[model samples]
Target: MHTRALVLFSGGQDSTTCLADALTRFERVETIGFDYGQRHHVELAQRGVVLREWRARFPAWAARLGDDHVLDVGVLGRVSETSLTRDMAFRMEAGGLPNTFVPGRNLLFLTLAAALAYRRGLTVLVTGVCETDYSGYPDCRDDTMKALQVALSLGMDQRLLIDTPLMWLDKAATWQLAHDLGQRADPAGGGDALVQLIVEHTHTCYAGDRTQRHAWGYGCGACPACDLRAAGWARWRGERGAG
Candidate 1:
C-alpha cells in the first residue's frame, strides 16, 4: 500500500477537501501548488491559511501533513491564452471547451508531482480534478488520468499510483465527503468546522474577489466556478435539512 501521498492542492474547495481526505488515509501527506500566473492568484495565498488552520483545528491530521511545495511554472501562462492565464471572457472556445480551461495545466502538474513524489519516496499522488460538477476540461477526465498514470509509471520506471477520489463525485457529494472526513479527524466539531473552514478560507472565484463574501463562500458569485460552488452548497444544505 502507498503510505505516503503528495496532493496537488490549489487551496480551493475541491483541493482542500482532497487534502483532508489524504490526511485521513495516508501516513504522510504533502501538498504541491503551482505559480502559473493564474487570474485567481489569491488562492495561492490562502494555501498557508488553510494549512495553519488545519494544524490548529485538527491535531490528529496535522501530524500527517508534511512539507508544501510551490513550483514556479509561470511559463504555463505565457503559453496558454485562456481566461485563467489572461484577461478574457469566460465563454466556450473554438475547441468546444470553456475558456477557463488551461491546456496542459493538469498534465504538467501531475508530471511534476510525480517527479517530486519520486524524490520524496512517496508512492501515491492525489489530485482534486473532477469530471462531475466541473468545467468541461478534457484533462480532468478519468481516462486521461489513467493514461497519464500508466505513461508516468512507464517513463519513471516506478510503481506510482495516481488517486482521484473526487473523479466521480459531484460538488454536493464533495461537501459531504469533507464533512465525513472532518468527523473522522475531529469528531467533536469536525464536520461543521471543516465545512465552515472551507467556505471561509478557500478561494474559487475566477475574478479573485475576496472582499465579497457569500453564504457558500467568498467569490464574485457570477463566474462559472462560483456558480458551481454556490449551487453545490445549496444542494448540500437542502439535502441535510430534508434528512
Candidate 2:
C-alpha cells in the first residue's frame, strides 16, 4: 500500500505549495479546510474554486483519493478575540505580532484535522507553516507543531506524523519548490506568483480589505504579512534580474 496524506489546505500560496508537495509524496492526497469565521470570507470562497481547479487538473490523483472535506469549525468564531475573527480595529505592525492572530486558531484547526485523519485512517498530515517567514505567530513554530503531534497521539492512542515541508524554508525557497514541482513556470512568475496568488486569491488582510493592490499583493502593505511578502518578492525579483 502506498502512503496517503491529508493536507490542511487554505488555498494560500504556502498551503497550495504544500498541496503540490503532497502530490509528489503521497499515493493519494485529500484536503481539509476549516471556516473559522475569518475576517475575510472571500478567501474561503476562493478556496472552493482552487480546490475545484486542482481536482479537475488532477483527476487520476483525485480518483485514488478520499473525499475532500470542508467543515465549519467555527467554535473559535464565538470566542475568538483576535482581529482575525473580531471587529476590533487594529493597525498593521512592522515586526511585531499583529491583531490578525486568531488565538488558538491553528491549535483548533489541527485538533480537528487530527480527528479527521484518525477517522480516515491516515497516519500522515501535511501542513505549510513556514516558521522563517512568519515566526511571529506562536502557532507556526516547530515546537507548537511537535507538541500538537505528541498531544494528538497521546490523546488518540495512535501515532501520527505531521509533516511541515515548508517549516524552515523562506518565501523565496517556497516559490522555488513550487516551481520545481511544476506548479509554477517562468522566473518572473515564479518570483511573484506566490505574492499574486496570496493577494488576489487568498486574503491575509486583517481589515478584510478586498480593494486596492500593494507591492506585495492586495494588502495594506503596512501589515506584517504584506511586508514580509513584499520583501521576499523584491529580493527574488532582483535575484532573477541579476541572473
Candidate 3:
C-alpha cells in the first residue's frame, strides 16, 4: 500500500512546495485546508483551483490522493489576540515579526489535521511551516511541530509523522525545488516557479487584497510578507543570472 499523507495546505509558497514534495514521496496524498476567517480567503479558493488542476493533470492522482477538505473554523480568529485573527490596527514591528502573526494558528490547524488523520487511520501529516524565509512566527518552527506531533500521538494512540520539507530550505531554494519538480517556469517571470505561483495564486496579504501583485505575491508591498518576497526575488534572480 502507498504511504498516505494529509497535507495542511494553505496554497502558499511553502505549503505548495511541501505539497509537491508530498506528491513525490507519498503515493497517496490528500490536502486539508482551513477557512479560519483569515484576511485572505481568496487564497483558500485558489487552493481549490490548484487541486482541480492537479487532479486534471494527473487523473489518477485524486484516487490516490484524498479529496480536499475545507473546514470553516472561525473560532481561532474569535479567540486569538493576534492581528491576523482580530480586526486590530496593528503596526508591523521591525526586527521582531509581522503584525499578522496568528498565535496558535498552526497548532490549531495541525491538531485538527491530526484528529482527522487519526479518525481516518492515516499516519502521515504534512505541513509547510518554514522556519527560514518567514517571519518570527513561533509555531512555524520545528520545535513546535515536534511538540505537536508528540502530543497528537500520545493523545490519539496513533503515530503521526508531521513532515516539513521546507523547514530547512530558504525561499530561493524553495523556488528552485518547485522548478525542479516540473512546475512551469514563466520566462518573463523574475521569480521561480514557486514564487510565481505564490504571486499569482496564493495570498500572503494581511490587508486582504487578492487583485494586487508584487514581485512576490498579492500583498501590500510594505508588509513583512512583501519584504520577504522582495528579498527572495532578488536572491533568486541573482542566482539565476549567476547560473
Candidate 4:
C-alpha cells in the first residue's frame, strides 16, 4: 500500500536498477544520492546524468520518477579513511573486511533517507543493497536492513517499509531484473533503449574511470566493482544464450 518511495541511489548498476524498479511499482518515486567524500565521486556526478537521460528517454514515466536529491556529507569522507573515500589501494585481506568498505556508509545513507522520507510523508524507502554478490559490508545484510526499518519507524513514529528488491539477487539476476523492468516500461516496440541506458550510462566502478569503457559500463576493469559487474554481465549473456 506504500505508494511513495525514496531510493538510496548511488548511480551504480544496482541502484539504477532499483530506481527503474521503483518507477514501475511506486506512484511517486524520488532518489537520494550522497557525496560522502568517496574517492569515486564521479558516481554522484553520473547520478544527475542518469536522471536527465531517463527523463528524456521515458517522458511518460519521468514525472512518476520524481527528482533526485544529492546530499553533501563530505564530513563522512573526512572522518573515514577507507579506500573508497581516499586514494588508497584496494585490499581485502583474509578474515578482514575490505578497505573499500566505507564504515557506516549504508547506515548513514539509510538513516538520512528515512529522515527525508518521514518529512516528505513517504512510507517506503528502497535500497539496492544485495548480500549475494556484495563486498561483505555488514550494513548491506538483510538483518541489518530489517532492524533499521523497525528502528527508523519507532524513532520517527511512522510506518516505514525498507524495500530491498535486490537482497537475494546476484549481479546477473539483478541485471535480468533491470532488463525485465525496462522492457515493461518501454513505450516503443522494443526495450533496447532502456537496456542500453543501464549498460552505457550507469556507473558501477569503484575506481570511477570513465575513460576505460567496456560492454558493461565505465570503470577501471581491475577494480573489484568492475570485476563483479563483468562477471554478472557474462552470466546474464550466458543465460540469455542458453534460453
Residue-pair clashes per candidate, as listed? 0, 0, 0, 0
Which consecutive 10 residues in model 3 have the weakest lDDT in total? Answer: 182-191
Query: What are the per-model C-alpha RMSD values against the true structure?
Result: 1.1, 3.8, 3.7, 1.5
> What lDDT score goes with residue 165 in model 3?
86
Candidate with the greatest TM-score versus the true structure: 1
Give the clashing pairs for model 2: none
Error of 3 at 175 (Å): 0.7
Off by over 4 Å in 2: 56-66, 91-96, 183-200, 213-217
TM-score of 3: 0.85
What is the alpha-carbon lDDT of model 2 when measured against the actual structure? Answer: 0.73
Best-matching candidate per lDDT: 1
- Candidate 4: regions farther than 4 A off: 187-190
Q: Flag clash pairs in model 4.
A: none
The C-alpha stretches of model 3 lying farther than 4 A from their native spots are: 57-63, 89-97, 183-198
What does candidate 2's lDDT look like per residue over 44-109, in tens digits? Answer: 776776666555555544465567788897888888767677777665456577777777888888
Clash pairs (backbone) in predicted model 1: none
Candidate 1, 121: how far from true, in Å?
Answer: 0.6
Candidate 3 displacement at residue 235 in angstroms: 0.9
TM-score to native of every candidate shown: 0.98, 0.83, 0.85, 0.96
**Model 1 lDDT per residue over 1-243, tens place:** 789999999999999999998998899999999999999999999999999898999988888899999999999999998899998888987878989999899999999999999999999999999998899899999999999999999989999999999999999999999999999888898999999999999999999999899998899999999999999988998999942
